[model samples]
Target: GGGTGMIGDPGGKTAERVLLDAETVARNAEAIATQASTLFAGADFTLLNNADWLSQLNMIEFLREVGKHFTVNVLLQRDFIKDRVKDPEHGISYTEFSYALLQAYDYLHLHREYGCDLQIGGSDQWGNIVSGVDFIRRKTGNTVHAFTWPLLTDKAGKKFGKSESGAIWLDPAKTSPFAFYQFWLNAEDESLGEYLLKMTMLSKTEIGAALELHKRDPKERHGQQLLAREATTLVHGAEEAAKAEQVSQVLFGEGTLEGLDADALQMLKAGAPSREIQTGTGIVDALVVARLASSKREARQFLADESVLLNGDPITDPSETLGSDDFYNGLALLKRGKRNICVLILK
Candidate 1:
């Protein structure tokens, strides 16, 4: 089944959401369905609109069936509602207050139509799932099961699947497959063992073997690579995963500028820290602009040490002005010391 795209559930102490426009909700629903199809290929699925039934219900009928079962005292006592309502900065809204009832009615509708018995969600959703179950029991005298997986977190106690940039989105346009792979590949050594087994559908024995290899040589990043490959392949498909790996190797490994085209070069450049240099600016000025070195003095020091690369060639002359010819077919490669490389595409 597809997601309901609910506007704002009264489950958290957050600001009232700007409800999505009809067109925006439609687009989001389509994207969600596409992602779900990838994860659950060949499975029977139904995309239902809660508004279909919800809008049709009159006040009297809703009060008689669903609303009668819920008590104001009990609803007010719910931790989520209490906390949200108590918060001065982000007080709850009336629309949000009725969110639980709408969700419960959704469950009742689905159960009556499809005979759906189980609901699964993240640990944070336990309260909502149980509320649905309670509504079904009260209305139809039927028992329903609900299950939740504990929310995953990293070793540092931060939420999983998020980075400094933002959420690791499933859409390739939002987040490239290369970036997705790199995220998993760079997972911490401490959490690698448990994360590999839990996050992906890899067999337990395979996971154990990968863990053993990881312990044997942590620097090799065996487990991390596997996690990246498996997860990326699952989400973006095998072919895209292979390309992502290739791009990663060329950028991070011994592979150099010759292997990358203009597009690939641009993608690689995006991964590195970068700065802009105006046309005809000198290499020293470019270095200063990039903040690769603190000042002109340090820029000179780096140049003297043969630490700067212009289009993959070391320039000993600090005074050398960057010309159109210095660019690699159209892009200028900038490097500080040797480990960090960025590309400057002429705009």
Candidate 2:
């Protein structure tokens, strides 16, 4: 799979991919392996790099043994391949055209060395998965299985797992646990059920209960909350999932500021306006400092309107002062309304 990744899977692409250099591919493969180790920690599976055998393949021998089994006519009929061939602007390259052969060989090698008989992938890989099954049967005269599930897509038919920022990454370094959790937290109501079924390991009974609760009040977003929790837990572990959920609740004004660690507060800081203020600062001054109000006069007006909150509790008194007790782990939150929040850092 690592070797195949280098050439890039052309199954779902509209144009030829820029091939990865050996060093980049190797680094990516290693990083993927590291992530997989944590993701599949308790699973009964062995990870293998396809490059172990694929890199050693002799071109002539591969053509004779693997390539000979596949016909150009069949390859040309693949949906992606056909689309590429028909599009003059982005025609398929020989390197990409041979992707199926390489993937087929991966299956053959796995079958011979590991007794693997089943290959599962997205529907987009239907052709490649079938090619593997057929190659295995042709090479060893043994039947294998290919299973493809529908790819998750948005209502508009574009693929899921991408945000306005860019493609979501499993690595927290690329997409923080908070960002990852938010992606699922914001799942559309129409697709929440499918996301729960495909993206989470929740049992049908559990999902049904969540859906029932959500139906009672979609405004509660119970289904999305459940999906977000389960999906985040699956990828980032239970502890981080809990932290992400807590941060989300705090940001949304549904949770208290107590018990948030520095990392969680740091994440919260990123999404809200922030300013430093001295201890015992008056609410009016704090509001202006945090930019929740443009001026002390306006800040007092907001407070008088009961539209201000200090650490999630509505504060209507301009005289109310933020002291050390108000800061949680050196940070506090100010709010003029549900959506306008600011982080207050102790100075």
Candidate 3:
């Protein structure tokens, strides 16, 4: 994705891409390399950046070597290309139009250099992929195979990563492990089976069994839980997955906050409402501050009803105070009933 990242892939776009600067492309390439290395750990593979060759090509030489094989008529016949060409406001750019040739050259280069014979990508890349296959056959007269799977889409038919919220990045900095785990955990029931089958490394037998179990009680979300756990473990590692799961359980009242540290509690900031308050804040005031109760009167009523729990202990006394002992590692888990929860971070 080195050179290709600069000119974004126009597979499913309605408009031309804003080209990236060289530095941004390099940074993105490095990030992608790191993620690929982490995800494909223990697999036998060599990572190669197409920029290694693409960046060194002479225009005239490349036109003679590769461009001549591709025809405008064939390129325009592609669905994406055709769509772009039909658009009056945002016609395709020559840079993007030439992507197929570059990709075709990539396949040829890999086949010649690394003896790589197979190219795989999403169904969106079928046109570009076949272009590569045709290029290789023409250049070296050697046959190569290509395969593509259907694009992963949610229930709304939008591609998985292109959500309205924004792209779900693999980088932990861009999207936290907890957020990433939650994204899968909140997957729609209709899409759960496809997500489990495609996203995780679970076998068919295991998936079938899980689906069967999930069918008995969809409310339990056994399938989603499994998918979330497996997907999070694959991307962020087992420890991070465990941490995310722990935070999730504590938030849902299925687990305790006993072992949760500041890091684990931090994950709750996204799932549960939180506020900062000094230690020794009155229980009534704390509940109000947490938005679990509308006012001091409401807070007191909740406390009087024995519905409020401070660190999982029912607090019936409105006069009770939250002190340093109430906080675990600068964080306190406050619960009102089973559904509503809030975190108080000591200021």
Estimate every model's Cα lDDT from 0 to 1: 0.76, 0.87, 0.87
* Residue-level lDDT for 341 in candidate 2: 85
Worst 10 residues of 2 by lDDT: 159-168
Tens digit of per-residue lDDT, candidate 1, span 38-122:
8677788876666677667787987888889998787898888888778898887877877778778878888998888988888
TM-score: which is higher, 1 or 3? 3
Q: What is the C-alpha RMSD of each candidate to the true structure, in Å?
A: 3.9, 2.4, 2.1
Please write out the lDDT profile of model 2 over residues 258-341, one tens digit for every residue. Answer: 858777777887756788889988989888888888999999999899999888788997788888998888888888888888
- The digit string of per-residue lDDT tens for model 3 on 1-347 reads 78767677787788888789999999989988899999999999899898888888899988999989988998888888899999999989998889888888888889999999999999888888899999999888999989999988879898766445656878998889998898898898999889998989999999999999999999999999999999999999998998899998888756777777767767777657889999889999999999999999999889888898887788999888888988777778899998898888899
- Best candidate according to TM-score: 3
- TM-scores for the candidates: 0.80, 0.91, 0.92
Clashes of each: 0, 0, 0
Whose TM-score is higher: candidate 1's or candidate 2's?
2
Ranking by TM-score: 3, 2, 1
Candidate order by lDDT, decreasing, is: 3, 2, 1
Candidate 2, superposed: residue stretches over 4 Å from native: 161-166, 270-273, 280-285, 288-301, 317-321
